[model samples]
Target: MDGIQEFNPFSAGGLDQHNDTTIPISDRSSQPAVLQPSQEPTPKASASAAQVELLRQQEELERKAAELERKEQELHSRGVSMGPENNWPPLPRFFPIKPCFYQDFDEEIPVEHQRVCKMMYYLWMYHCVTLFLNILACLAHFTVDAGHGVDFGLAILWFILFSPAAFICWYRPVYKAFKSDSSFNFFFFFFMFSFQVVVYIIQSVGIPSWGNSGWIYAISVIGTNLAVAVFMMVVAGFFTVSAVLSVILLKMVHGKYRNTGASFQKAQQEFSSGVISNKTFQSAAANAASTAAQSAFQRN
Candidate 1:
């Protein structure tokens, strides 16, 4: 009793203290942590990149479409509209002779055909200039040798005749052919232009007594008058250049014609149709028939 006398209710034993102790949160930290599953951003990142590429492609296509639209607008502005005013022949308002033809490369000719058509126009101009220069050269020749007066006369005659004739026969036909895509006009141009090429070759050759200031006449005059001969030679060179250009242009036109689906049969058809549809032809036919009827009635 004396040795165990100090045990009281306020004092706790070791087993009782152990039974009341609680485990701390840090004690469980070493156990494998049960974390919520995190989503991988790789699929989302790839999807965003794909969307960005698609957007870039779409923007590129839009830019191309805008560029094409701009080009089309420019082409339209270049006189593709209907009923555009003609600016060719560029004659002054006060001139006695008005422009007879309505010529506009942008309005009348297709873009692909305009270049060759313009070249043909320039060739015609060159041909005119060559003829004028030939006349001058022939005049000089005549001044040196009065016996060559025939060449001067013929040169004047050729200048007067061939200038208009070339324009009407070959140039106009080709112009109309390009303007309307007429098979008959194209064939007519080919025929006339072929003859023109031959004439150019002849003129370049400078045969004696011919109106042309060709190589032969130029060389002949060289002994008599070197100044006149040099001048004539220069003109002869021009004729040669004209001939070469004519040949080249002829081939170019033929190539264009081949692409036009034109044929001899089509040309014939176009000719017949054009003749039938022409007001002048119809009037002439009617007058001829009336005259024939009157003659027959009187005979009866």
Candidate 2:
């Protein structure tokens, strides 16, 4: 009985031991199945990941290319060139005129002479305004005296003529003088502007029936009519101011010219160049030579 009990096939302890061993084997098999799926990725998922990686690389390449292009453009604008190609005076798009004729003021005008150039330009603008006011003053006078038509007409003519003439005679010459540092242009502008200053003084004098209400009209109309007197006074004041400014500018320009050595030597050279270039002078010289040769031949 004791041996049967010890080797019993229906024992609870033996069944429990067997169940524990079998449970371990089943858990091991389940772990391997779970790990196998994780180790081997699906074909569709791998292909999608590869496509995403290629797209990321393409974007990175494009970004690098754009950065390089931006750097190249920046260098080009600063007068830096790759290879032998250089663009100077980088022209504006849709501009009809060439950049050579209209130089960039900020880049071309020297720092030393910029102030003088600006002052000269301002003077020109002042002159234009003065002329316009003169016309208005003439019209006012015309309203008072219908016979002052001549004054109005002459004022208009002066504006039309002087505007262009001033630009051509003084402004452009001074501009060229500063731009090129030419002694001849400096002398030309000095002489021309000197005459212009004299003209300003004369215009400020306010001659009657002449389109200006200078000091003369301002004083003359004082007791006649207060309103007209005030108007004349205002006009006279404008003229006086214009005259004073013109004188001051003339002095300033003269000082600059002196500093540039626009002396008698430069004047002579300019005059000689002009005479040589003049057709009338050339013709006169030829005639004189011919007459002298005829006299010499006759004497022989």
Candidate 3:
């Protein structure tokens, strides 16, 4: 009975022992602990990742800056402007005379002023054509009346001299004024173009022996040769049209100038500054000063 009691499976003590045995092992050296709530991301690791991202952004910005610098250097090396290049006088690549100026109405002129600028360009072209035709008319006049040789020679001289002079003086100044809103250029255009208008009037009047085929000359030849008179009349009509257009354009330009907010003070300031900055002007001034000093010293 004693042995049985000691080994009893249903005894209170034995049941208590079994309950203790069934409890999980406290000393589990081989089993891994449950993934302890994944350790909170370390601040250091997070900082490292952020730094990496920053480095990538910094590298990208540096690359863009380097590329921009490279492009600027390339442009400088090629002697090209960062803005649009000059493509005026769009001559053929093979032409002996390269373009002397750069003109782009769309690029340089304001949208509001482009129409007026284009009209001015057209006027210049018409002026050139008129001069050329005047030469032909004068040749015909000379043919009909041998005494008109002076008229023919003067016509040739006017065509040669006036064509380029008009382009350089009044037309170019107006073009520059519209392009840059330059106060100095505006004033220059006003002064020069006013004179040009007067010249146009005189040309249209066709003073005899003055190298113009104007109304007076045309009427004078009416009884001499009908065909020649008609030819001269046609040329005279062209001169009349040129004069009228010049007057109209001069008025238009004056109106535009009034709207430009350019003052005489501003024009004077620009002129002074331009003269000071011009290398050629500087040299000329220095030479003149030196000469004056020498002359004064010699007089003493």
Would you list the C-alpha lDDT of every candidate in the order shown? 0.91, 0.75, 0.89
What are the clashing pairs of model 2?
A: 206-214
Off by over 4 Å in 3: 1-85, 283-300
Give the lowest summed-lDDT range of ten residues in model 1: 79-88
Judging by TM-score, tell me the better candidate of 1 and 3.
3
In model 3, pairs of residues that clash are none
Model 1 residue 243 distance off true place after TM-score fit, in angstroms: 0.7
TM value for model 3: 0.70
Write one digit per residue (lDDT tens) for candidate 2, span 178-278.
Answer: 77667888888888988987777878787776666677755665665567667766767776787787778777767777777567787678778988999
Tens-digit per-residue lDDT, 1-300, candidate 3: 656634788888789879966846676577677666777788999999999999999999999999999999998899777866557678898988777678988888998888888888899889999888889999998997899999999999999999888888988899999998899999998898888888888888899999999899988999999888898889888999998998898888878888999889999999999999999999999999999999999999
lDDT rank order:
1, 3, 2
Measured on C-alpha atoms, candidate 1 has an lDDT of: 0.91
What lDDT tens digits, residue by residue, belong to model 1 across residues 110-135? 99999999999999999999999999
Candidate 2 global lDDT = 0.75
Error of 2 at 207 (Å): 1.2
Mind sharing the TM-score for model 2? 0.55
